[model samples]
Target: MRRLTKFSSAVVGLTVLAAAGTAVAAADQGDDWPYAHHSAASYTLAAVGDIACEPDDAENAATPASLKCGSPTLGGMSAEFATAKQATAMHPDAVALLGDEQYQVGKLTDFEKSFEQAWGGLKMLERPAPGNHEYYPYAKKGDNEAGQNGAGYFGYFNGHDQAGTPETQGQAGDDTADKQGWYSYNLGNWHVISLNAECKSDAFEHDCSTTDSGLLGQETRWLSHDLAANRRQCTIAYWHQATFSATTASTATVPASAPGAGGAEGAATDAWWKLLYQHHATLILNGHEHAYARLRPMNPAGQYDPAHGIPEFIVGSGGEALDTLAGSPGNYDNPNVVTAQAGAFGVMKLTLRSHSYSWDYKPALPGPGFDSTALKYSDSGSGTCN
Candidate 1:
């Protein structure tokens, strides 16, 4: 596995210092911080994938019905990223793991391995949303291990709740301090929300279709009440999985829009989106796609709706093997779709300016594995709905 070198650490440290300086420079220029400023500065948050310390060998196991990366065995494809050490080196203010941070099974031991690796370099900064794997019931018959998917995840992350701090950009209430794992925070001018996908699995057989599932019950109530109460200038929701994807790789893999009603799984999130729109949301970021994609502002139905659309981003390529794009490409086919890139691992960087923000998808360094070019996507000179 690739490890972080002292030199790289120094480089990142220097870059972070430089960014701080730039923020200062902008303040000196006019206090209209661009890119690195406090009021108008940008902070980075990355969404990553089905990270596994032990990848299952397909020859010996049946492939997961929904996961497309094939069976993950011990250690992932990237040797350099053996641990979350690489993520720490990048020095993002915060980091997000989409789901399947472990593998096909959700054992506490397996979670420890995956967590140790994923949180290696980023122990202090890692904030996660539980995936379906984490919620896999521990008592299922015939399953290798009867594990409650998120027990370990919540055990570790729930205690590190810092959502109320100014760094996260929210006023975490008593509920946040108590719930911990499923909380919201504010950093700079953004309200960041971390959700547990396992919440959607509270239904029978741990399916999204389950009404009254704990996942839906808790998050929906929280989201509804929270959105109704938030007064932030910009809201950014980050989670471990995607509620909607234009790709047709696996329907089972796609998250349901609604919690239990299930009219349109993705549509279930409309209430939250409407609340965000009412409060002026800026973006929604997620992982679990094992690839990178950006969607134009659109409604839950994937229809173009500039007046109410919220920009959605799937940045699941962080240090994992990228999944191939599954659907027809280009604007003609998916009008609400903007861009999709497969076959590369990357980090997404957003630079927030006084009037707008610019985002960049920095592919991994060119090698036999993934591409290494920096592709920039901007949503500047545009106004977010309020």
Candidate 2:
């Protein structure tokens, strides 16, 4: 496993260690020197979302088939476990859990039985954001069901006490009525923000307007403050749903007016995209679409802008069943989508540098019905900071 060199303040006076571990005199160091004491010149991050299937999913009980626990047919490995192994193989400095980490209402018992069995090992290194499944019950069918309201998400990521004190829930974000899981932190030289996109869920009473006088408004205000106070040259923000999408489960082609086209649920994030764009955020990672898509850099309006646009990547192909692409197999309907795939379960590996970043989507396992060759699907590229 590769390791990041830890340089002490004493060494800063004489020589600064570059990302490549070459010793350079402090006098020759550039202005981009990392200010954080523990900052690394470069680091790796493995990211994915829409992970473990519900432990009680009917597929688990099917003859010669199991989707929750490992199956003997697949060498005693579940899809989630296979992707977890793929992520662990990278030895990333941190894992950005995009969200929808546990399916079917995200109950605590389900997380422990399914998600934990595979992803628990990376819990300490995981930076999480909540998804609809974490907040709503029965996938938002009526909102009257017994929902965890992020209790399972917070309880698992923050600790066991579902109704614990603020400190216990700090890691996952405050799940109170006012603050709905939005926080920012510095990683290496980049500012990483995790925002909860379930603003319209039952937890928030379906009020996601900027003037919503509730969690939505509070979250937006906090995000604005966070962005204003950030000083990092490179920034990235993540949540569950995306402002741009390449697929919707019900239809092969998403209508322009649908929520999948940044309408309903995705529209709730318009303010967020605007703020990040204004702040020159470098990337936006999302995972509610149940497929993988690499969109070209674009403004908050969804217009392609190579110069000052924030690119978005939908990496929902973590472990759950894959969704269809926007159009025919080879042709994607969304013009902004540069590339997309639906049959491969994978993790996006990000190599973050002081002033730039690179991404490599590594397929771990094939989804149902896909042959072994599906594992060969790949998407990789490098980009400089905005």
Stretches of candidate 1 exceeding 4 Å from the true structure: 1-40, 53-86, 137-145, 159-180, 199-215, 251-271, 331-333, 352-355, 365-386
**Model 2 clash pairs?**
none
For model 1, residues 40-106, the per-residue Cα lDDT tens digits are 3556554465565333444314444223223232225352263244454444655656666665455
TM-score of each: 0.66, 0.82
The lDDT, on a scale of 0 to 1, for candidate 2 is 0.72
Q: What TM-score number comes out for model 1?
A: 0.66
C-alpha lDDT (0 to 100) for residue 228 of candidate 2: 96
lDDT of 1 at 264: 36
Q: Which model scores highest in lDDT?
A: 2
lDDT (0 to 1) per candidate: 0.48, 0.72
| Count of clashes in candidate 1 | 33
